[model samples]
Target: MLDAHAWVCCDARMIQATATIRCAACILFLNGCAAPATSHDESRTASSASSPDNLSAATAIAHTRPLFDVMTFSQWQVVGGDARFELHALANPQESAAELTLVGRGPIPRNGFLVSPRELGDFTLTVDVRIGSAENPRAEAMNSGIQIRSRRMNVGQGNAAQWTIGGLQIEIDPSSRAWSGGVYEECGRAWLASLAENEAASAAFVLGGWNRYEIECIGPRIRTKVNGVAAAQWFDATVAGVLAFQVHGGASCEVAFKTPMLIEHGIHEWRALADEVSGSSGERCAWQSTIASTTRGVRLEIEGAARVDLLADDGARLASLSTSPEPKISAENKAKPSIVELLWMEGEGAALLDGVRVAQFACVTVPSRVRVLGESCAVLRAESLQRK
Candidate 1:
């Protein structure tokens, strides 16, 4: 029978959920409410979620992969320093929406974020944002942003203790100046790039209205847009982490987010996040990584988002590129099996593999050389790039 597990699965918009519904017609539970779902309701949900071409700005979001989850305050956890915030539903009368308001309380405060428990690698995230002014109405007042491929980290000690988020933040500054769509590293490196750096893009943000902010992160290269205009971009080699919404500190401020949606590729981490939810079946799909054997004893590391596994051939494991301590490779420790095949999951535009992207094939086997995607998101292969 459809139990509580089915209830949570239905929340993600994927409810072929493995649990048999005892009474699909008699009773339908959605977000803790009992309502009867009709044939038309079922058909519309199935079509919109599965059709790639059906996606549009109007109505509900349509995506290729089943939606991982909506960024509702229900599944998010407040992190960083001692920030105090309140999350509540924003009644739209006809549509589902929510808001996150921070009272801006805390000592030794730097910034606060509402981070999802799920770690994402490659995805497109969009949200409607309204930047609010702080108590004093200074530089920190007109600040709010969406943090993608980010992490929650704590630094300092004692009263100096600070809980801060480190990673890339899409800068949202709606003041006398226009730097809303710029890209800034929260606590790591300073600024990478911004619309303020570009003349024409700086005018993309429209004042005094709901602005749609989108972040397209494929591997290390990230492109941001404000109201559908290109704003800022930067490239790095690491591309995997949790997504978060920011409330900049320094003054008592309020920020609101509504209708957050995400489109993901190679979603191999949903089950882990589901396990944390109550009564979730935690459905999992298996994907194997193939070892591309070029030469003996040479190490090859494929770093993506979330958990990292050592790529191995025979019994010997390839050393990791990071200074992070070596991982113990055992049958029990690693989940997926390493095979003899090599394929890049999605295209460079949507996702990346081995830091190189080959656009010709949906998923190509280990090629001798491939082009690196450019700033324009075009795939370029260097043929000379041999895995050292």
Candidate 2:
């Protein structure tokens, strides 16, 4: 008795559950498939297998390299305000992890950042953060953030010389509002995504204590999680920039980053479709394909006058663009090959003709196919971004 929409939802949930069970079984099978261990290996394995925490420690020991070396801040630099950075050993004698602490001196004149020297494109970063310590108890009220796809620029000159760092920021707010994990545009368009309506995400931050943050960026899509709870999912045009840790330009703040890890997923590559189709004399040629919601864009090369339409799953037009000067293509007119691109993210879409935008539209739908209609037009090449 379930409706079409309800049935789809139920089917999706069932598939997810099945996939999770299969993944767990695969892990167990792989573990059992390992070669027989030596006496020393057996002893080590027995000790770690005794508890999940011990197993996690063993795994950590296997991969001890961090994204940056805290022992010497060679990969990082401080920009703007007078903030002090130091490496401190963890208080726990049993643990070998160290923390990089940033302490601001009194009130800062402008926002200061502990920024990465190199720029990153698509990547996954995880960090354990603590807002305040016994020595800086007032740091709980301070504002801070982790910046991705950001840049530093000199805004003034001479004695008035000042640097400004701006880009996408994963907020580390410690105020009563508790918007930790929200996405904000630092020195840009302001709040890009907020956790105000998401009670669980907003309440995930523990005041004056350590919390884990995981951020993933692939193409234009960005997602964040706070202590295992999904926080934000958004998209932006900025694809590459430096990563940074911010100390807002106001009150003194003390923030510690521990065991910062990173996994670089290089930029998404464009893959060409296998089939090519041509449309001529008012004939329409269509290519059926599913465009993932996370796809950054689609590219196609058209030779001669043509109109391309991005169609939704229901065959409805989501966005369209045409190279023809008139509504209908003239069979006598011939044109050279031109590259056309349809870029989309969620509700917004833009069409570019040879690297220049010619049309833009807003629609809340997933593109599923591409259709070309024209006279004497041929789609030479079609490409789509590979999913992460």
Candidate 3:
């Protein structure tokens, strides 16, 4: 009996040890499995700033260097200068701010220009431009701009292909066009996005001061702002290219571009001119090629005096124009709605779209299976499972 009791106690001890070992091995396996998931989550968190849509609103400081330096001295080249402008270091790059100054008086001063990393389709450029108009009353203080999607023509003159070489010039003037940020087609075309009389309020600029200028471009839509007020907006999907700044012959302009930022989806924006336009009587913007999809479809957000028109694949008329400026359509599938839905909602608030006189806002998402013919189109899906 004593031997049996001892054997029973040993058996119980062995069973307990086995159970403990199994629990330890299970815990170790779970921890190892969880390690990979944790690493993946961290990686995704770090890459959150790399989205394409986020680039639309991206900006960089003129005098400061960002953590990521895409614009370096080596990346810049000059024309018509003989060491005229001195690269000053008044502001400490590491301490306060870094500024590159053009300090000289000559017939044709050296101009500053930056080459983009890659060719951009649509973008908005912003920079702080100041002129020394106070020093010389006749001095063309600053006449430069943030050039985009532009091909290098000659040393100083290139053809933008969209209009002139300087696709869009942020007028840096302290003389006649004071603070007016108007669009001037370089050597080829001459169309003023802003009239002198219309831009009076914005032209109330202070000479010899740092004023902010923002130029927005998406697909074909373009808008510009001066000192936070609306200047000009237009639509022109002509060229997808490079960027530069031009300091015209006698006009001494010193302009700096913050980081080149972009917004991918909603190309259309709003301008003050939108309030002065007209919309269709009962016309809705068409998005699809099929008559069935066009007629009984939703009306996206319309701005200003934009009239809607429906078109077939062959550019033929299809559905009647939706007079409704804002319309929402439900998709046939259970998936979420597309860019069209987002823009139809968000674009309504924009004051500018592309680079022309478009009453409709930009950046509408379309269904992958569908084709749009009008100014814009977008795809949408229901949030919950619902019968169409």
Tell me each candidate's TM-score: 0.50, 0.58, 0.46
**145-247 in candidate 1: lDDT tens per residue?**
7787776554757545344568888877876568888887788766667565676667777555567888887544578888888887655444567777676
- Model 3: per-residue Cα lDDT over 2-93, one tens digit each: 00000011321321111111111110111011112223233223222221322344343334232113333222323223213322323333
Model 1: how far is 387 from its true place, Å? 17
Measured with C-alpha atoms, the lDDT of residue 322 in candidate 3 is 26
Ranking by TM-score: 2, 1, 3
RMSD of each: 17.0, 18.5, 22.6
Winner on TM-score (1 vs 3): 1
Q: Which residue pairs collide, candidate 2?
A: none
Task: Tell me the lDDT of candidate 3.
Answer: 0.37
Most lDDT-accurate candidate: 2
Candidate maximizing TM-score: 2
Residue 47 lDDT, candidate 2, scale 0-100: 25
Instruction: Point out the higher-scoring one by lDDT: 1 or 2.
Output: 2
Q: Residue 355 in model 3: shift from native, Å? A: 10
Q: Which pairs, if any, clash in model 1?
A: 81-163, 370-381, 371-380, 371-381, 372-380
